[model samples]
Target: MIGERWINLAVPLALLAVPLYALMADEPFTITLATRATILALAAVGLNIALGIGGLVSLGHAVFFGLGGYAMGILAFHAQNYSPLEIGPLTFAGTKSMPVIWLVAVIVSAMAALLIGALSLRTSGVYFIMITLAFGQMFYYFAISWSAYGGEDGLSIYVRNGFPGLNTLVPIQFFAVCFVVLCLALALNAMLRASPFGLALNAARQVPQRVETVGLNPMRLKLMAFVISGAITGLAGALFADLNRFVSPSMFSWQLSGELIILIVIGGVGRLMGPVVGACLFVALEHWLGGLTDFWHVWLGVVLLGIVLFARGGVVGLLTGKAGPHV
Candidate 1:
């Protein structure tokens, strides 16, 4: 218990410490990297709610990620062009407000998740996995063919969206914004994990039969988890688009979805702070090993293989002596 508690607090603080030191040392690039990791960690947190807790392995989460990106893209694109978006008969004006963009992203993504989950949850195991993957690919192709929003080339935001009081143009200020959101998401995850619904979800994941015996609808619980998961991931997607000032079909790619899952596995599946640890490690490798070799992914694969075979608990599990519950 002591070790787990230490690992939980230590991982996030260490992450916080690095960026602080980087800021003090005037290494803006490192701060950017840290911010990327924080955003990715936020996305993985969403997945953890469903994958880690609900036992739903969705390879199509990129659908929500891309949806969030497009939400930002479409809104900011119209705003930048000074045109109102016309949908059938209703004319919607675009605004550069970050809060409005985030709200739209969350709502749209949640709706998408609900629609997808309603159908996908009908199947289990390999079927569920394939169905999710299929849905993701469907969206990927749709984005590719939709030339109105840059099509294969992708969309770009001319400027960063507006925040209440901060100048988001500053790298550190943007980092602060993302960091606060990450912390809030972490708090939400902690709250959900400690709630009755969380217990029921975990039980449904572990033993659906028993959950059903208790009159709890496992499908409903999973669907709710999926919706919340999508909303959070969508929010991360909006941040990611803002981070790059661009959105592309690549956001909906299988590779990004796989990386999100890999983040969860490498950090510690189902463990709080697992995604943070995973994202940091991933970004570190991308920054360091990427510069050393063109085939850095091969090395990453080897390391992941070792973890899968040897340290199933990932970094947090290895350090804290707690194995991942799902695997």
Candidate 2:
């Protein structure tokens, strides 16, 4: 238990170095690599709530992620075009600040989640997964067919989104935002796990019948958790769109959804810091393997197969044992 605590504490602090190293590293490739890894980890953390704790096993989380990215992209486009988004009667525009983009991302993703969860939560097991995946594909196709924001090609931003006090375009500063957000997500996960609501959610995951017997509607609890999960993942998506200064349908694809699951499995399902560690290891492996061979995914597949076959609990589980009961 003490070892677990130490690992838990050490992991976040160690992650702080990612931005610093990226800034000071001589190689630009390494810096970009770290930046991408941090953002991906943030997305995985959001998925963790639904998959790890709620046991929802949603295969279409990419929908929320893509929604968040498109939020950023759409807003940035409007802002650049200096055009107002005309609603029924209210005309809206965009801001250059990151906070504004993040807020919009959260709201949009939450609303989408509420809609999807309402429909999808009506089903269970394979049906739920299929419904979620179907929703994700719907969004993916919409993005591809919609020509407003570059359609299938994608939309790019001339400048990185700004923060009040930092140079958003600087690699280190941007990475710091990603790292800090990742830390915040982990902290929030820990807090939620310890909260009463989190306990109920976890109980629902283990035994919905028991949770329902205790006067809690498992569906209500799961739906709430799903909304929160989608909002968090959407925030990560906003940052991701900014990281690439672009957004495309690819962000909403089933492949992206699968990768998010792979992150959880590789790190240690239900572990707060698992996504972070998994993201780092995954990025490192991809980098190294890519340097060695053109078909790096072939090697990555082999490695992932090994982990799934030999490692029951993933990297974090191997290092720190099973997560606590709450997790």
Top-TM-score candidate index: 1
- For model 2, the stretches where C-alpha displacement exceeds 4 angstroms are 323-327
Per-residue alpha-carbon lDDT of candidate 1 for residues 1-327, written as tens digits (9 for 90 to 100): 348778778877887887799989999999899999999999999998999899999999999999999999999999999999999999999878999999999999999999999999999999998999999999999999999999999998989998999999888889889988988998898899899999999999999999999898999999999999999999999999999999999999999999999988999888888899999999999999999998999988987897788889887888887766574
What TM-score goes with each of the models?
0.98, 0.95
Worst 10 residues of 2 by lDDT: 318-327
Q: What is the C-alpha lDDT profile of model 2 across 32-107, one tens digit per residue?
A: 7778888889888888898888988888899989999999998888898898877699989876789999999999
Per-model C-alpha RMSD = 1.1, 1.9
Mark the 10 consecutive residues where model 1 has the least summed lDDT. 318-327
Q: Candidate 1: deviation at residue 105, Å? A: 0.6
Candidate 1 residues lying further than 4 Å off, grouped into runs, are none
> Candidate 2 — which pairs collide?
none
How high a TM-score does candidate 1 get?
0.98
